[model samples]
Target: MTRSAPRSQAAELELPGLVRDRVREGRAKAAATRARRHAEAEIAEESPVARVLVDVPLAHLDRPFDYAVPVAMAADARPGVRVKVRFAGQDVDGFLLARTTQTTHQGRLQPLRRVVSAEPVLSPKIADLAAEVAERYAGTRADVLRLAVPPRHATTEKEPSPPAGPAEPWTVSVAASAWAGHDPAEAYLHHLADGGSPRAVWQAAAGSVWPLLLAHAVAATAASGRGALVVVPDGKDVARLDAALRQVLGEGRHVALTADAGPARRYRDFLAVSRGAVKVAVGTRAAAFAPVHDLGLVALWDDGDDALAEPRAPYPHAREVLLLRAEREGAAALVGGFARTVEADHLVRAGWAHQIRPTRALARERLTVAIAGASDFDLERDPFARVSRVPREAHETIRAGVATGPVLLQTPRRGYAAALACETCRAPARCGACRGPLHLTGATTPPECGWCGRVEEAWTCAACGGRGLRAPVLGDARTAEELGRIFPGVPVVTSSGERVRASVPDRPAIVVATPGAEPVAERGYAAVLLLDTWLLLGRPDLRTDEEALRRWSNAVGLVRPGGRALAVGDPALPALQALLRWDQPGFARREAEARAEAHLPPASRLATITGEAGAVDDALTLLALPAGGEVLGPVPHEGGRDSEEWRAVVRAPRAHATALSSALGELQRVRSARKLDPVRVQVDPPSL
Candidate 1:
């Protein structure tokens, strides 16, 4: 019995060791199996080294990495093809940028896991453009590539590309008369038809058929056997441009690429452009990267529209993208809008592009403009012109015009009483809970804080302790209600925000719309009322005057020839004067000069860094200011998502813009490498 007990105790002691040995043996076998499989995986004999752009958004890891291409993926692993690869011991998606005979990488390279698809979805030109855009915006290439390339859909990728349409010969005669109004317009078309790159900032005349004109330009380029890209501000513009393109270039010559088209449709349209099925691509901002085969012309409409500025990281402006594309591909550029922007004027002033606009005499004949309180006679006649939101002259104009055609009333805000003030003291009302501006969502609903959505059950004036509230700023809904009451039995329609209408009937009616939401009238409005001019011009923004003029001009452009546009502002205001005289270019020049003197954008380069206080401080510490550069504030900013964040502004001469961007980019890279929180770096932000 003693001997048996000793044997059992020895067996128990050996059990754990035997189990460990079995597990070690299994691991060794698995390792051997993996090694054998890796060794057996054949590498491509020719051009075995593949440079891949992994889909890592880390700024520090933005560059391409070397990977050995497996023999099985040789045919499929072409440049611009999507592939799965082992990156940092994890499977990741990447684009095969190029293949080389050998790589400079000295370490043992990992082979690609598999090719995502054999299709070369990303074009070399687009890849280059994306990289350039990233560098210019101080963003990672992966971020820009995400914008350039649509997400892959296996079904759509498997589908065959649409057959290319037969080429159509184009000539200047096709659109010569269409361009006769503006001097050199015919010349621009001829240059496009002749395959010459001419850069022009075109100021579209009032009531001008701009869609058709742009379509003519695209057709001219297409006739030259080169492609054209046109980017507008919104989906409504896309629809108009699409119709115009069909009218001029016929069907199947172009495809519209917009996020609204759904993923499958958007991807299909992108594939069509990449496969050379279509030569013309028109859409919103995302279409700026459309890979047109042999690009010839790149045009953008309404470059100042906020929609053209991407809201995502890096926040690239479509105008800059088109400009970059034109410079890179030697493509003609046309920056056309109802009103000229300072940036557009800079293009002309820099001799990079010429201005195409009608003579002052022609412009005056095309547009009839008036300003409330412009002259002593107007003020004396109305007696309340300066104090009234809708003056006697404006009301009379609307009353008379409604008999002829539609009348457009453009409001700067969209909701019902967008701002409230104390009636006794004229001080803006604020919520006690959050100190946010209180606004009425409707006539019956109580006022609520815009920022925190806290209901102000009983709000009192902070200054003067007034109990009554008065709407100092009226939105489209309130304006519409007032207009409806003023003009009884006259059909009134409101368009703004998410419920914006594309067009209104030509019949007699009153259309109250916010800026950028005005609906097109078939024959054009007989009269347009630019209401609440102070709302746009009074904003605490650097581009207040410019943006006000833009919105006013857009509304005025919807009026028919000889139609009246009455703006409710001091006639002497520069923006109003520009509209009154139909001289946007002159206004743009003067504004640009003023900005230049102030060392603002176009004349200088500016960047805004906003984030948490510590993050911002870290970025500032890392920032290497260029020569002649200045840093403006570390001010408390409420613009960031986090309430505790701050903002800093960096400024430099225009010549050192690239240097500033590079410095900011390096700061981001360092922060990323150190695993620090990121700060938003925006070059030439739309607003200050």
Candidate 2:
């Protein structure tokens, strides 16, 4: 029995061992195959050292690293092309910056994993600009590149870009009449047309003809066989500018690059610009980095709009990017807006850019502005003029204007009742569950928590223990509802948030809109009513007054030449006076002087460092401040989810800005090296 063991049982016992042996052999063969291929790959002899900028966001690894390029990838591994390289034992995406014969790296260099694309998306100009922006903002280069270049779409990349062609003669003549009162503007266009770079800060007159004015400048630049780029605030402005460009320059001469165009279209437009297939690029914030060939002019509208600021690490402003490009590329620059910003005024005062503004008489003829509470008649007619959101004078103006054409009512907020307070005690109503402010979405809707989105069926005032609620502030929805009742039989249109209307028919209608969401009228608005002016002026930010005046001027600038604008605010306020006199440049000059005297920004550089308490402490400890640099806080920061988070502000004079940014960047590198928690470093944040 022992000699004749069961044959079936013996075969089954050997199956497990046989399977294990086969798997081991297969793995070993695969490993050997990879090793043999790596050893056999040929390295390029000439310019073998390829400098690659890895996509890692860590501050410590921000600079380009040298890697050996294999012969197979040498042709496709051109500068500005995308590639993958071994970085810290992991294959990471990178941009090939350059190639050289020598090597600064003493250790053996690793070969590139593979070439991602042969198409050169990152232009040398854009690469340098990204580096400058990162250094200026105290951010890692990779972070800036993320904003500079859109993600690659393989399908779009595979499509061949149209061949570069001769510049087309503009179809429509430059509308020189649009700049009739602006002598400097006319001269600026002529200079651009003659291949001269001139920087100017243009103050647009009241009307919707600004697009045409910009088109004239862009066309003037294109006539010199140079490219132009225009950055606006949002997609609406993009559409308007795109239409104007086509009308002036003809079809296929320009492209609109925007996030709203979908990733594929955006990437396709970007490639078209990079390949010199289009000479002009117009879009929102990201258009600041459009790789226009032979860049000649960089212009931006409404630079003060919050939408122009990048809401990411580094937080570069579109205006700053254009300024940088204009300086680096020897290109003309135009910072144009209906209302001037202190930064733009600073450029004029510094003699870096000239101001192009209409004469006082011209401005007054084009616009008619008044403050609701300024006149004695207003106070007499409505005793509640000081407290009423819509004073009697504004109401009357709206009523009379609606009879002629569309009337635009600009509100500060967007919801029905953005904030609610107890009627009896005047205490703000809050949700018991979240302690968040209560608001109403509609007249019949119950109160709900703004932060948590929880309906508060039984909300109470914490300060006064009252259940009753009243809206201290009215939003666009509520204003539209009230206007409907006031002007019976008149159609009421509302525009705000995601439901914003681009344009309204030139008819007898009342259009209520939030700031930045006002619709363009076909024949221009007959009247512009800026309601609740105090809400804008009451913000706690440092730019409150400047921003408030900017908003009011933008609204008032929409009125027809003989039309009127009435704002509900104190007449004595500087912002209101500026609106009445149509003197944004004067107001901006005063604001710049005030900020310089107070050592606040535009006169100085400010960097905000925010993170967890311990992380902030660590950064501050590692920071080596430049001479005259100062730190403001380690105050509790409300930006993060953790209550223990803190914020510190580092400030320096304009002369020492670079040094301060360098020091902050070094400290960030140290934190990264130590593997500490990440902290945000934002230089010149739009708000402080």
Candidate 3:
């Protein structure tokens, strides 16, 4: 027994030595592996740390972060290429902003997980532009990057389709344009041709060939061995500018970069611009950011169109982006439209741009305008129309004008009926399920929610418990139906919503359409009836008058030179007067003056803070408002009783715009830190 005990003790001692040996061996192997990893990292030390703006999309994490470049991935992790990294414990994609040896981050930087692409999707100029835009609009850099660079399509990058030549050759002379004689216009063109960035804000007579004028300017820029970019509002304007640019720059000089061109085609065109294949770019709003090389001129037509305001976050208007690009790139800018808005007028007023006016004689020669007053119509000519909504003068003008060509009737609304309201108390009817405002798409169809698409058959108004509904404002369909009954033999064609006709044959027809949906007549419309003018101007919006004038002029501009337009409203309003006398600039200047007096936009900067009532109130309390800034709300956001949402408006003088923006941005940063309820922040919203 004693001998066995000695052996057990010896065995136990040997077990401890064996365990220590195994532990030492494991430690040695781990140290060797770490040493090899350190050696590899040292080899990659030559590559700078990449400052990547990860696609986290959270407003709080919008800034750039430092990432260590590995030797294997350093070649492909160049600035502007998409890279994947471990962020918040998950691998995610990001855009490399810059590569630098120095970083401000205090923590140990994580290695870039992998390189996603080496295509340089973002350019240095675009990075700078996006940053400036983010600062200007109080948006995140990541948001703007999402807009500046499209998603990468591997197939599109691998192989591109053969470029197609223009269907016909284009060779229009710039000097033969309608505005050749205007000294300011001539000087602007000469400046572009001389490689100078002279800004011009041109106002053209409505019926004049304005697209041709723009094309001439673009051609002047292209003539100096530089590129030009022209951004319009929609596909129609894109087509017009595309056609005009083709006429001026010839085949293959420009590429249209609209999303409607399909992702592959758009990406191809973008690549073409990056490759210096095209010197001119024409498209919708997104084209304002087209990567045209050595951009000499940036022009936007009809900047007031709502389509010019991007629907995505950061929500930049094309005009603002173009303005910034022109400043940053030293590119000339042309901000012109049929009707001017306060923003454009502010540019001219501030002397940032010069006003380009056509000669009075030329304007008179090109535009013919008339007014149909409410009380001046002849009752004897057509009693039915006079007694009804349509005036006798409208009937007479349509009858006489149809002999020459088609007639356009512009209504304010688009549906079969105006939004339904309680017949008794005049309160707007709403859907029971979604609280969306109820609208009638047809006379017999049940009332449906415009937002939720819910049909509300058993709906009653909250106010007065009324069941009957009435349309306070007339709509295009109802107006068309009424007009069809009035003009029995005339072919009545309705154009609005999904069935918007781009152009009508030059024949006798009554074209009833909503605002922004007027069909172009081949030769020209014989006459235009600006119906429901009161509804247009009576809206409680800041840009109501401006929108009215823009719409009225756009419709009237489609009329033939000798034809007339009869507006069915008071003729004394400055907007109507502007149309009657072709005084858009004068009207815009006056509108700006009025807005300045009222402390509205253009003269002052405005921002809206909207969210849950408590959250909005708390945020406003934390705001560090600049001097001369006024806070004007906490009101119900939806203008309804029992509403939980609220809104606050901050107005600051033009001189304090920068301070105001900075303060708002700081407040947003603090809100993010506190993790407060989300609130939407918008600067200079098109509508108040």
Candidate 4:
């Protein structure tokens, strides 16, 4: 048949239509390839072009939108560059993640309104770490992205700050090499030199020197010819550390980043780091994501600090942000705290981080500290918690400490945030649910329970019918008032919310403040007073033991070496005992063991799924996963407090956490394919 084919001269006259169609098909394929390459090159040439994936804060949507970049600004217009763009006919600040040759839009592409000045605000490494954090926390990428950048510049029309020149590179070294044997200051310095940055926890006992302790870490890291980032709890800490670091690194080698700086100044520091002018950065939570170059180490002074917890859209924890970044960038992480948080303990036990703990033997020999009424709450307790009452011994200690200098009093509540009510009606004279106290500060206001959305008619104490009720639990103001009575002549100043900071006291004074508001002892307090030890140690949260221990340690840490601090609880209650002996590492070890045995979250894994019942059901159907996984409530209840819809929760091993999360994410994509509902997904939710 092949040989005879040559004889088909007549058959060689093919149909004109078929021949033309073949030619057109080949030309179309060639044109399609040319179009794709052209689009990629055009985007590469102009705009801060990136397939920006942002979290709009909607419960049900998770995706990225492609945006074009202006050519002249493409140099600094790379991934993690915060940019201004129009979306849904409105302009918003978005982090430019990465440029892409693909797009999901058929509509005309929009160019970035302007680059947010590529001052390297969001480093490439941090950007990747942010995405990973979102994944580990079962949170949205946009959620973490939002965290990586500060509040978007207010206007689409704005001028960029003037540029700053880069500063010379810096180096680090310890002040006292002999200090390393058993003391934490030395231990931490040695830890840094050992390439221990990926993860390390520093647990120092009370009386353990920390400013000097952290200084050692900073110096060691700097000496390695790399960068270091340190984060403290608040302004007082920033001020204190700024002075300490300058002593070693000299002026202008480091920058202090706190919100206290005026807007222009803050922007200047932000740009300084962006321009590599500042090799070392220190600040509160926001500085954890600093964009320093060749970062070799990261440190957090206190891990349990609420200040480290960002309350914005993603709500990422700073301790965690640094932990994740350290691993990803191969940098050392030293979480230095007077007391250890259970979460840090978990990392240590799991071999994810080293427990840089000071020996109890060394701690015990330094200060003879003890909880006076260690076994009895009556010795030191708060009325609000219904624990043992505050004791006479603890009171006496404060009386004694105050004579030498300032007596630091730690309260459990601050601001108007703490309210009181009538115990008989189980309601305090409040503004019904707002929990605002129904006080006659001005006129005779009817007493009501701030909670329950109910107002009492002439709500007088049923027990006494006296329409007046004082705070059931005293706030910092009330505490200050009482301390005034307890020590009539001593000046009583408050250090609670609003009146948060305390100046260094030169004479005998009583500084009654809430936890977290305690000011740095400008001249160092002669003695510290712990009012409600049990109340803090026995709260209802999962991290209660951990939190209580931290607060106590921080309070005790303010004391001068020869000065003393006392906790009023059964010092035998492991946590209090740890306090008496100043044993944070041991306490952390015990807490870590308890957590792992419980198989509860942080030990295992958890995820929250919420959305339309149909979509949730679809996801559940796909997850016939292994036994390590468990799905909790899609039990169908009235959500939104009063809405008619339903929601559910799914918890599983962390190993399969992403699969379950993706199933949920894909369900979202599928649901979005048609319509969406008011569903929310939170992985490793900080709180339910």
Model 1 ranges off by over 4 Å: 1-40, 166-171, 374-388, 452-467, 639-643
The better-scoring model by TM-score among 3 and 4 is: 3
| Per-residue lDDT of candidate 4, residues 1-688 (tens digit) | 4455453443544547787677678789999988755544465543333766554654245556787765645676777667778877788777776786666788878776667656446666777787676655545667776555555344311444333233334333334442443444454565566555546777765555576666666767777667888989888888878877776666677777877885656666666666676668898888887777778888898878777777664556788788877877888888878888777877777788766665656565445566765344332344443332345666787788788888787877664325556654546554534645553211244444444546556555545455545555555665676568878898988887677784556578888778887876666677787765656765656678878878878887777656777665555688888877777777877887787686656666666666567757765665454457777778564445554545676776657666765565555455545565435555555544
**Candidate maximizing lDDT:** 1
RMSD of each: 6.1, 5.3, 6.8, 11.9
Q: Write the per-residue lDDT of candidate 3 for residues 475-570, one digit (tens) a residue.
A: 788878878888888888888889888889999999999888888887778888888787788889888899999988888878776677788877
| Model 4 spans with C-alpha error above 4 angstroms | 1-121, 151-174, 177-198, 260-262, 372-390, 415-459, 463-472, 570-572, 609-627, 634-649, 658-675
Model 3 lDDT-worst window of ten: 164-173
For candidate 4, report its TM-score: 0.76
In order of listing, the candidates' clash counts read 0, 0, 0, 27
lDDT of 2 by residue, 1-688 (tens): 4586598656646679888677678889999999767653778887998999999989889999999988878888899999999999899999999989988899888998888999988999999999999888888889988988899999999898775444446522345666777746777887898899999999988874788789889989888889999999999999989888777777778899999999999999999998888878999998999999999999999999999999988889999999999999999999999999999999999999998988777787887887876553456654444544576787799889989999999989998998888887877787888788888999999999999999988776778777888888888899889889989999999999999899999999999999888898988999998888878988889999999989888887888877888887778899899888888999999999999998888999999999888889888889999999999988888655457779999899999989988888888888888999888999999998
lDDT at position 655, candidate 1: 94
lDDT of 1 by residue, 1-688 (tens): 3445586456656678878677678889999988766653878899999999999989999999999987767888999899999888899999999999978889888888888888888898889998888878888889988888999988998888786565455568869877667878998998998889999999988888789999999988887889999999999999999999888887688999999999899989999998887888999998999999899999999998989999887889999999999998999999999999999999999999998998676687777898876452356554433433677788899999999999999988989999888878878899998799999999889899999999987888988988898887788898899899999989999999899899998899999999989999988899999987876887889999999999999999999877889988777788999999888999999999999999999999899999888999888888999999999989889654557879999999999999998888888888899999878998888988
Model 3 C-alpha lDDT versus the unseen true structure: 0.81
Cα deviation at 323, candidate 3, in Å, is 0.6
